[model samples]
Target: MEPDQVLSVTELTREIREVLQGHIGTVWVEGEISNHRLQGSGHQYFTLKDAGSQLSCVMFRGARSGVRLSDGAQVQVHGEISVYEPRGQYQMVVKQVQMKGQGSLQARFEALKRKLHEEGLFDQDYKQDIPKYPRVVALVTSPTGAAIQDMLNILTRRAPWIHVLVFPVRVQGQGVEKETIRALEMLNRAEAHGLPVPDTIVIGRGGGSIEDLWAYNEESLARAIFASQIPVISAVGHEIDFTIADFVADLRAPTPSAAAELLAPDVTELKRHFESLSRRLGGQVMTLLDRHEQTLDFIARGALKTAPAYQLQTAEQAVDDLEDNLKVAAKEQLRGLGDLIQERQQIIVEHHPRIMLMEAAHRLENQAQQLQQKISHKLERLADQVTSRAQLMKHLGPESILARGFSYTTDAQGNVIRDAADVEPGQTLVTRLQQGQVTSTAV
Candidate 1:
């Protein structure tokens, strides 16, 4: 126990570790997390601090899998204290982590929100449109709640014609989700059974805490809202309150009365619209009548020619003109016929057979002279062509070819052979000469 008996650095650190580990054993430390680092080895290291002090902490992977950790989050950690031998530093080895108080509820809320978001339940593409003018609004909530009465009052004041069908269900506590889901199913079933189907559905409650309004946040309820064929208007809690139902619904209303206001048409507005439409129709009819009257005036002005006596007089005038035109045309036609007959007679005189024969004989004589000249020209051209052909034949014929010392070979059938491959060894061949062909055979 003297000065010489003092421990070494490692030994001293080890002793301190043992003492702190034994004394602190499995203590609960509440602090805000900072300097958080999650290692690739699945170990999380962080500093847990209060306003006054800070402590190093570590959570090895697989210790608390369900808890999601982040910096600045207030958490209650359950673990034991330990020392890192190399650095001789002490740290809390956390075994379990829990979010504290309202943080806990908020954590769960955010967690569920993230889960539903990842599931595409919060997708706007899947959201339906709320009915603009719902004729039958199906109300799903507590029959005793104030939301239903407010909605009823609003609907009554705004649109007395819209029929509201109420389906009573618990809006909070145990079995609320199940009851709501069951009610939705029942309404859908009724519609499928050919009953009065709701054009729209209103699900809401009065303002309350997140816990009080948690029925609307249930996953099954959100799914039910998404699956509903009838457009859903979610009006849970107050304007400030938001639940999962708000995200999944076809339309989210700030309050129950707001839902009614959205679904119904104001009677005053409708009355104004009706008056405007009636005025427009009256104006259009008056305009149409004016057009008809103008058209009738135009017809009256032009209808003078439509009188029977006027029509008959017009027909008589037309007949007189037609008669005059016919007479003129007949006289002109007779004149043309007489001229044609005179022309035919002149033609007959001019084309007497004797005169025609004389003209024909003169033409025949001229043609005969032309034909003789053409025959002479043709014979001269033929003689030139024959002489040229003879010269070409003299140069190209076999006799000239033989004189040039060139020879061609043919088979006995007189087919000229150009390639040696075309002749077999025993095939009879003829050597074509200018004078005659020489017969040959294979050896």
Candidate 2:
């Protein structure tokens, strides 16, 4: 007889798996990736290592969607760490993986930026050209900071003649969006009131962490920049930094100094261009003067120099003829304009509705007078009928009947009677006139 085995191999494997799974469920493991390889089946196999130890990790095809895993990439994985019975090796089956804390945020930021960029939020066609010679430039940033100082320095160096207007506002932290939006509104109001409008707006701060530069990520600030009538330049954070405002702005510069450079022309280049144009103009003028000198030399040597008086006389007669023609034309034009005005006036008078309005007013007055007469007649008739009815009512009044020495009598049945026979011998009867009532035993 063989020794009795309580469970089969399959059962034992399942039992061991249950125990291992129960003992070690999900855990967060932080490590650096090594030997990362994507399989033909699209699964990822890698070893996660800390300074002292390492564990083999497998990210299945399903869980690896939209995930980019590479060698030497630091990652924190959440999943079950179990022993694989087949290979008898311990490994981690990853459920989710992301770059360690701030790296994870950066990954999400990159993802969002890629998505928005693919949607054409960062298209060059949407970018507006910065004003070449802006009269006023509005700076939206912290009132007191190095960013402002840097921007001011660069602007003064580049465009010292252009006005650098400051709409002092908070660049980061809580309520920054509200204050920034209010600053934009104030600029709009200034424009509405005909104050010098900003030609281009500069909104940014210096380099910092994501949290430190979150104000530019606000949707309100992004929409404000998009809706601005003036062009906007977003220079948020360092060269590697980006925000929604940067994507939506008409232009984005890598730094505040870079933004200043883009906003104004280079003074040296402008001076060079001006000098070149001035030299060209001088050359052209010299060429034209030489030609004129040649012409004068020919004319002095020709016959026209001796006939100056006849030329003067002919020029004077032409001037007089031109003056007379101008006078006659002016008078004719004035007369034509007057006739047109008179014709328009006659048409307006013929089309005027004032005459019809007067007729309507007269008719309204007549109707009102007729209504008044009818209302008065109805009131007089009503008054006469009321007086006649009053007299008739007075004649039928009980007091008038009582004044004629008449009285009304009622028995126990409450029936009014004029004869004593109407009541029985023991019944009580009450008599009523306008003045009083008297009760008596029936006779």
Candidate 3:
């Protein structure tokens, strides 16, 4: 171990390996995986790298963790630091591997997605319909980014008529969600904010990592997009990226340029459409005018123009026929009136006053006899009813009750004493029997 002792290449590598294993030992490292390779022998080799440095790592067949090992995967590895003696290189002998920072962000994304979905924010019923032709469009994006430039170019090229309102906002970093949300609010109540109301609002940003695009995934931003009166088009990141804003927005465009293409109708295509319509209209008008001109030509060359005297003679004959037909119709009408008058006279004779008076007299005589019979019967029935009522009254009279031996007692004032409590012990009393009245006084 002395400085004078010479060491072979193998010995030096073995010594270095020992030093790394004993000193660095087993430790955990987090980085993005790159140049990942899975050997046919079931061993995996990869490089773990960050911004400044890279470390070679290898996981043997036996230590193969079930976690997916792929390039660009952000992962944390647990292993012992060791040097490969044969290659004279130091590397980590990885024992375990798992996802790192991106995994937690993904988990948060999924959880927020579930919460908003359960709240009906992602429901199609709540999604506003994007106008087919937006007159005014508000772009909420970073003015300095490639996204805004791409959108403006597309909007200007496709629909030059569209009024573009650019409300610059931070599309990334902390508090970006609040800025995006504020832009949406201003665009929704644009008139109140003294800004022209936009028919559509486009929230867009260039492609980035999930962390960079995390602002669009914010719950508040998603809710703001859901609450927006103006339809929102979410164009965050690439086509593969999905955020909560994409799910809650009225429409999801794959990119910022795609959102512009959707909002702005191509001027050339619209012009072609209008030109086709104009051609069709013009053809129809020409066809109608030609038809009317043909009719006029036929009239100009017809018999009415070429033979005026013959036409006039035919008109005189037609008038003569009409006069004769009117004569016949008038004679028939007079005959009908004469028959109607005769029928009326016959009806009047049948209904003469003398005949009606005789019939009335006969009916009156018969009615008089019936009236006398009804009056006699009524008087008899009334007499029977009176006799029965009189008998009933006699049976219920007070004289009949006195003859039945019922008696009554009264106080000196001649008031009937029903209850004994109503009379005084020393007061005068009169007892009325069926035949006589008895008077008594206190002793």
Off by over 4 Å in 2: 1-126, 192-195, 306-443
- The sequence of per-residue lDDT tens digits that candidate 3 reaches over residues 168-265 is 99987888999998898888889998999999999999987778888888888998899898899999999988899999999999999999999988
CA error at residue 262 for candidate 2, angstroms: 0.7
Regions of candidate 3 where Cα sits further than 4 Å from its true position: 1-74, 77-99, 299-443
lDDT of 1 by residue, 221-323 (tens): 8898888887788999999889999998888999988888898889999999999999999999999999999988976877454686886788899999999
Residue-by-residue lDDT tens digits, candidate 2, 1-443: 46676777666776777777899889989999999988899888999998999999898878842236888877789899776778666789998886667555666667766766777767788777898888788888887978889888877886688888888888767898888778777776676766678888888688876667777776567667767777889988889887887898998899987888887777778789999999999999999999999999988986569888887898899999999999999999999999999999999887679977888899999999999999999999999999999999999987789989888888867788777666688788888877888989865
Which parts of model 1 are misplaced by more than 4 Å?
1-101, 192-194, 304-443
How does each model score on TM-score? 0.48, 0.47, 0.53
Backbone clash pairs for candidate 1 read none
Q: What is the lDDT of candidate 2?
A: 0.82
Query: Where is the poorest 10-residue window by lDDT in model 2?
Result: 60-69
Worst 10 residues of 1 by lDDT: 98-107
TM-score of 1: 0.48
lDDT of 1: 0.88
User: What are the Cα lDDT values of the candidates?
Assistant: 0.88, 0.82, 0.91
